[model samples]
Target chain A: MMRNLFERTGEKTLGFLQRLGRASIFLFHVLKGFPIVLTRPKLLLDSLYSVGVLSLLIIVFSALFVGMVISLLGYVTLVDFGAEQSLGVLVALSILRELAPVLTALLYSGRAGSALTAEIGLMKATEQLASIEMMAIDPIRRVITPRFVAGIIAVPLLTLMFMVVGIYSGYLIGHGWLGVDEGSFWAQMQSKVQWNYDILNGLLKGFIFGIAVNWIALFEGYDAVPTSEGVARATTRSVVYSALIVLALDFILTSIMFVEV
Target chain B: MTQAYIEIKDLTFARGQRQIFDGINLEIPQGAITAVMGPSGCGKTTLLRHIGGQLQADSGSVSVAGVQMNGLSRSELFALRKQMGMLFQSGALLTDLNVFENVAFPVREHYQFDESMVRDIVLMKLEIVGLRGAAQLMPSELSGGMARRVALARAIVLDPALMMYDEPFTGLDPITLGNIVTLIRSLSKSLGITSILVSHDINESLSIADYLCVLAEGKVVAQGPVEVVKATASPWLKQFLTGSTEGPVDFHYPATSRANDFHLEAKS
Candidate 1:
């Protein structure tokens, strides 16, 4: 039993290493094709519309609800210590530093990331990729690099938008709804939330998460087995892998930025 | 026979354990239609991939227009590919683009042609395939045969010297099938382009092909002019040509015997 277990584990480890090697090569090709994609601006713009603009509604709605809930929780907790005025700091810091970038990435993975996987997977299954190859056009440059650039551009932008909307909704709850002192709330938030320490770090995290999520998504699609079921599985894996990578990268980035090492 | 435009010699390839092609040799004459017919899972499509330089041979070489496909650089292979065109079985049109844009794709990819020139070339190719009127329709809106015609239009848009049709007649209605067969014949003759058609549609292919090759068990079973293919003495070839189930070709995949699998005793 122990031998079988070790054998299976070893095989799995080898498979994973093989996949990692392939993904690294795919990334290299995508980066190499980046300049070629720039010459075709319309491809990038279309990808932005799909990956970023279309995802606006869900991001805004989720941000508002999350912001309100965080404010409510923070107010109730702080009221016990007569520090209810600090509700703004709690909500603003959480949204700007943690919630905005992480939640935006998770949602982006579910929405744009899965869609990208499905689209590219279907393209492969239907032999569109092969057709492009037969035409002597590299599908990586023609198809993948534009979407990668667009995702990197979109995720950070979406994270920033999420932060703004989340903070605004937090203000609405803390001052307008919960009846906290509006002047003290704004003052505390402004004093507490350092631009470089919190906001810039969050955007930096978003940037890294953007690269991770898009890389996972595109690689999954490109490496997918060419079939209907393969595409479906690839789409699922894209979202799941993106979510995991986003969360894991969040922890590492947070430790590096916020922790006193 | 004319000088060979595409040559395959001692080519062998495998996917993991199962060898798909074993020492297969072929010579496709310049500016003639060569139909490669084989059973399902018999590597007809794999042969096309070899000829197109998408898949490399294990033991031998594939040469297209005198250029060895194996060791050429990516740019060189791509440059070679520009002189070749392949119509995939699924039509494989870019779903996002309309038929006009799909047909214009190859031209637009290679050259900075004026819109008028692109449109003129695209429309002219579409007219040949009788899809000029359907240019504005999306791939999703197209019928299977319409999509195939559009793919063919795209394949020929660059005026390639070599054209490959991979199962060009599969999944088409008889009328559509006839149209495609006619198109394949006329295009090869009119443009004087060498053609390699990989298909199982024996009658349709034989109707259009000048030369015929029948592949079985990773080897060419029979190959000659269309006239001689009908009178081959090989029982395997005869059975295949006639579409008979009773032949050397097994109806079932290799597996345990039914009685053994079900644990039934043999009848005395």
Candidate 2:
């Protein structure tokens, strides 16, 4: 049993190494296709539409609900402590620092990232990549680069939307519904929130999350074994990895930014 | 004799531990159709991959139009590939792109021609494949044969010197296959382009192939002009051509085989 366990561990390690190698190869192709992003503006624009415009409703709804719930909870607790005015500040910081970008990434990973992986995975399975190479169209440029660029551009914009809807919903809950004065809410926000730092951190998290989601999705799609089961596995793996990496990076960034010295 | 447009010398390929091709030497003469036919897993697709530079040979060289394909950079290979076109088995048309965009893909990717030029060329190529009216339709909207024609149109859009078709007749109705075979012949003749077809459709391939190569067990079991290959006395070739189950190609499972064991277990 011990020997079997060690052998299983060794096999798992080798599998991870193989995946890492395939990821690097895919990354090379993606970087090589950067010129395509500039040249194929239509493809990039269409991808932006798919990744951003299509995702707007879901991101907005998720943010609104999350922010509303958090603010409502915070208001109840703070009112009991006679510190109800801190709800605005608490909601703003939560949305900007954590909820907006991470949750938005999770949603993007499920919708856009999984779709991207499935699309590319099917292409790979069907030998479209080989066909592209035969036609002298670099698959990296023609297929991956546009999607990558679109993801990078779209994720941040989606995160911005998430932050906006989240803050608006939080304000609605804390001020209009809960009867906290609008003056104290804005004052609390102004006193506690640093726009530059908060926005920068949000954007940074958005950018990193975008890269992680795209990289994982593209890598899974590109290296997917050419079978129905392989495609299913790749799609699942892309979503799971993207979500995990987004949450992990959120924690790392938060710790670096807010941890007490 | 016309110069051989694509010359593959001693080409060998291995996928993981499996050797797909070994010391396979073949040449595609300019302005003719050369067909590589074999049973499934006999490395016909791998050979096409080598010729298209999609798969690097384990050993040997692939030279296309006097350009050595072995050491060429990806960009250089891309340039060579731009001069060639490939039709995949499933047609491999991008589902997201409409027929017009799929046909226009190559022209737009490699060249800096204006939209009008690209549009004119795309339309011309589509017309050649008799798919001009189907330009706006998505690949999913087209029938299998129509999709293959669109793929062929996309392949030839750039006016490539060499066109490679991988299993062009697979899964097509008889009428569609006949049309495709005629298209393969006429396109190569009309454009003065070299064509290489890798297929399992032996009879159709024999009818269209100026030169025929039969591969088995990673080696060419028979090769030459169609008549010569037809006249050859190889048991594998005979069995394959006649679709016979009684010869060297065995379909029956042995009693002691793992497949047999699995079947018995499933039955029980």
Fnat per predicted structure, each in turn: 0.90, 0.97
lDDT of 1 by residue, A139-204 (tens): 998999999999999999999999999999999998898999999999999999999999999999
How big is the positional error of residue B12 in model 1, measured in Å on the Cα after superposition?
Answer: 1.0
For this target, which candidate reaches the highest TM-score against the unseen true structure?
1
Candidate 1: misplaced stretches above 4 Å? B246-268
Interface RMSD of 2: 1.0
Residue A23 lDDT (model 1) = 98
Candidate 2 C-alpha lDDT tens digits along B161-222: 88888888889898888889899999888878898989887788878789887888888777
lDDT of 2 by residue, A1-261 (tens): 999999999999999998898888878878877876686588899989988899999998898999899889999889998998888898999899888889989999998999989889999998788777777767787788888889989998999999889988999988889999898887998899897788778878898899999899988998888888999999999999998899899889889876767
What DockQ do you compute for every candidate structure?
A: 0.88, 0.80
| TM-score (C-alpha) between model 2 and the true structure | 0.93
